[model samples]
Target chain A: MSFFYVDLSVNQSKTWEKLFFDLKGTKRYNKYCQDADFYNVFKQIILSLLLGEEIVLLDADFSEDEIKRLTANSIYETDDILVNKQLESIESKEDLFQHLRQINKEWQITLYTSGTTGLPKRISHSFQSITRFVKKSENHSSNVWGFAYNPTHMAGIQVFFQALLNGNPIVRLFGLSKEQIFESISEFAVTNISATPTFYRLLLPKFNQYPTVKRLTSGGEKFDEKTTNALKQIFPNAKITNVYASTEAGTLLASSGNNFFIKPEFKGLIKVIENELVIHKSLMGNSDIFSDEWYHTGDIVEIISQNPLNFHFISRKNEMINVGGYKVNPHEVEEAIREIDGVSDVRVFAKSNSVLGNIICSEVVINNDSLNESLIRNQLQTKLQEFKIPRLIKLADKISTTRTGKIKRN
Target chain B: MKKEKLLEIINTIKKNRNEVLINSIDETSDLRNDLGMESLDLAELTVRIEAEYDIDIFEDGIVNTIGEILNKLENKR
Candidate 1:
């Protein structure tokens, strides 16, 4: 157990310090925050629970309609936990530490994932399970981290805990524009950042210079080689690591280079069975899908070699496009399109068709005027089969992504 | 702009979306709520309708329902 203080502005600091004592916890709960005001209070409630209770984190957005559905279906009631109140109480740090010592050490948190293919699901993790990958050294305490995700999200909570656990300061990136993000980073002298590939892609052009960012991490989406190499050029001093993780599973694999390999000890814990990545039930926390010996992560992968085993992530099993009878992986097509000259980024999706069942549709972003429909189709015809070629292509100045930075395939 | 051709397009969209088609779809059918058509589904519907009718309904702006698409096709003719 650790006791720490968040360095907020004077007014908010006093408010949060009061919340540290007045806040309460429950057995299991669903947390939702509408905007930043709710987020500020919601985070403090989580902090109080982390110090003093055994709780389970439920999955759902902070939307009223979603809450209505969850309440109707699940055991949750809207009145079970309310957040509109002002918490004003105070206790000394020594007394807070005493209360923290009596709390359950095995208390767990469930991060609900908003997956691309279907409805969101809950992913459980203990404090140990989440902190397993975080660097335990005190040297990182001086680093100021930048935060961009919802505080309740896995990636977002990871940032908060990583900083709070190590006594570091975190600056929220919510509601900041492309320009404002860079400005705040410079203003705070943020030394570390962990965001989705989409976030970094948007920030690259706006980020003229930021000498303070030293440790960078990308997760919650596919990390491509092109973006990795570009970031390397920009953040010369930052040690960039791309990780492959899912809500069903915690941090499974990570690598700074071209490919991600299953960690040596986790070799048996994780395996690619019939091209689909599967993890031992021990890795996932309290999920119902783990009745079998291994939980099948629907993510697909390709094994590269044997002796020193290596593998590359493909696309999600559901995200694969079936044209007539032939299966076409979107990642394969996206990779082919990226190789073409002047093509900056591309998102390939399955466009439903009457005769073909589903046809390939691509949204291509180009930085230069050299790309056209015929030029792209001609280039892809050489690398891909005739059936795999995209039938509909839209040229756009930019590609849009989900909040977590994955290409919005839906 | 025959009703048969328009029904065929709606049915194709319904099938592609894996939604269960109740009755035969008509011009009055809601594309979003009734047919469960998303933005991606709407995009493909635009392409197929363009190919079949040789006129783009989305040329001017966004098209919402099956009725609006039929109106656009009729106006183009």
Candidate 2:
């Protein structure tokens, strides 16, 4: 079976045979820190998991400072533990599939949160928990995925496992331009696509309908009616599904439309406390941040019904700013602005607006006179999603701080 | 002169999004349809216009076209 498709100009598309050939020659690592292209990254994760090795997925675009913080200075270090897997003996594609099916239960995958509040936190998941929602049926074998998330993130991992377990081919669509994404969908005859609402928003003002796409899934962000209507127009044949998941919890609730209903099995595990959705510890990944039996998801939801417990996600708690209907983490925006060359410090907060509930505003302190509001906004456009970019940017001599020395939000 | 400044603000938001720029706009130009401005774009336009004219064009009601925005600014003056 085909493995994945990449840009032909950069590298040749790979197949299961190529993956097998590479697997035989590759040296295994107990704890791998992968920062590579989509193909190599996916290949490494598969190899590590099948061999029962721990792998830390790092974003390719993460700055060195971010990497140092996330890895705790162990960026280049690998464990010296002995791994006794005889992957080389596997000669055929069937053998490789057999090996993949029996994934090592001890294998752990670590992922970092977007660090919306502070430094990115480590969340480790067992192989079973990570693939909790994966469906492996004969009907799923022929589906092709339009991979559209950063491979390091939880959403990407979910899509990867779903496609991998079904032995389905995936087309690389993350970080690609709108035109490139459209081209890949048609060229690959992609049947299933799962991405954040932001990713689908980039394809807005629809021009063409992709008949080949049969299933469309949106998660990681709020799905609005305008976008849903636009997607319906663009992919007439596709059945749209919305998923509610988090770094703390894997895929849990899904709906064919806006409101999500908790499955009967998950009724006791998931609940809403004071409008905030909470998940029982059994459904979550291991993290130090979770201290209580019920992990407070920080996601506020509006209950639509009580009998079946159907609800719609409203907004995030505390520091999250609701801009229009999109949730923007102030700290995430602050982090992006702080990456600008001349930016010394920045404080991102929300300002009330008549047009969109709230508009993001930032007060930036710069080290150089050459940096201005427009220049910084232009730079931020590259690093952040459009909704996260501050609409009103004010250059300041210094950011006002509280007595605790934290940047003041008010 | 006010309309010119407003057009510049609209173009700035358009440029950031990599959308087609409009050379000229009249009172009949619909912000959402003709100018292709979304809610976020409208928010940016409000902030930029507020910065220039010290008025919230969308404070009283939702303005659909360039004419409505001009009327708001004219009333504020």
Candidate 3:
């Protein structure tokens, strides 16, 4: 095994030597697997390498049957593995490598897009693409990072590798509240932090106490004006940067001033065709998705000053409401509400909130006057996550549509 | 102004909001996570807290954790 790989599993007892031994013994993992790193980190990384297989990251809370059913039709159907089996199989492997040449250059993982507008799409990522932007240095050895994002997603994976590759300690923040997370960060002396703008908002109230946080990062949602200002006021000494990256396009741009300008080095990979930020196929993880040379990001950006690359993100092409950094697809919410018997036609959209960047709101055309707000809420609770469910549901006579006959989102 | 009275008022509000079960809340419990209270729910909570205590806890800023709310109420009185 190479020195690049580090064992940052839930248990610190799992060593790199043991990881190498486990990696060598593991067979081809062609089956569907959840990439949530709540347990053994080395096991999953090794399994991905040995098999050179793609791992889909579903919400960790997803049931075993749900995982099996989702991956049944995919290539991972035959030898699919669950969360527990993934760890056990790796720990059970014996043949350890003394010294390995290099990691697999092929695409190692498959990440699903947020699918805020529609159904989530599978995007392939290679080791090179994923680690392209991680600035690895021993200077970060003294720093302990807070693993805030869902480990299965792109941001989470980036933070994991950034700390692990440098042999830095990481404090897991999943299932922890804002207050608890702050306390953990303070207790652990966490120096580096990365999370979505919504996560930052939740942390703002208690942010002042964690003075040890030397680096701050925000992504996964639009790095809005309010958040940038707040972050500056809160963590004045910290080097703050809002990163712009997607599952399709691995890390793209960074904005220290809240106006994300395409970095000078990656200028060749970026293009602004007609207002939308289009990237060259080379920058994207899945190049095959692009029929043309450029992949459309669907995010509208305004170019302020060109030289060193200065641009500001306007808004998403589709009106996707980001609730506390979690992408809530309006269509999915509408579909869930539509399933309720009385709901005739529902148009779901985003309503801005001071704390949470956006909240899900719906205008519904109900058939029965007897159907009440609580009935709709009760029905939605069974189908959707609490964040995805609309905060306000109002009965409308009809849904307003544009000339194209599509429901108006704005 | 006692802690017990404040807890009672909070439990009643949490029960009515349907954000969380009354059995789940406690002094150390976070209002957002434990009660699943979003900004709107927090706003509703603020209204109830004000009505019960006759004090504007949120006049300073947003209060999230249950402990913070109790402290604010105690200090206000």
Which candidate number would show the highest lDDT if scored against the true structure? 2
lDDT of 1 by residue, A1-410 (tens): 12232223221222334445545332333433333442354454455444433343443344656545533444343333434332222254434435434546656666557655455565667666766667646587677777766566677767766775565656656445776777767776778888877777666543366778898888765666677767777677789887776666667788885477777878678888899888898887776546898888888878897546688778788887887678998878888887776777888887665445677888998767876876787788789876677767789877877655578774
- Scoring each candidate complex against the real one, what DockQ results? 0.04, 0.41, 0.07
Q: What does candidate 3's lDDT look like per residue over A279-360, in tens digits? A: 8888778734667788888887788876766787765666667776888767567767866776656778876554566667
Taking all chains together, each candidate's TM-score versus the true structure is: 0.73, 0.68, 0.58
* CAPRI level of candidate 2: acceptable
The models' CA-based lDDT, in order, is 0.66, 0.81, 0.64
Q: Could you give the DockQ of candidate 3?
A: 0.07
- Output the better candidate (2/3) by TM-score: 2
Give one digit per residue, the lDDT tens place, for model 2 in A235-289.
9999999998777898998899878999998988899999999999989999899
Error of 3 at A306 (Å): 3.4
In candidate 2, stretches whose alpha carbon ends up further than 4 angstroms from where it belongs are A8-11, A76-84, A319-410, B1-77
- TM-score of structure candidate 3: 0.58
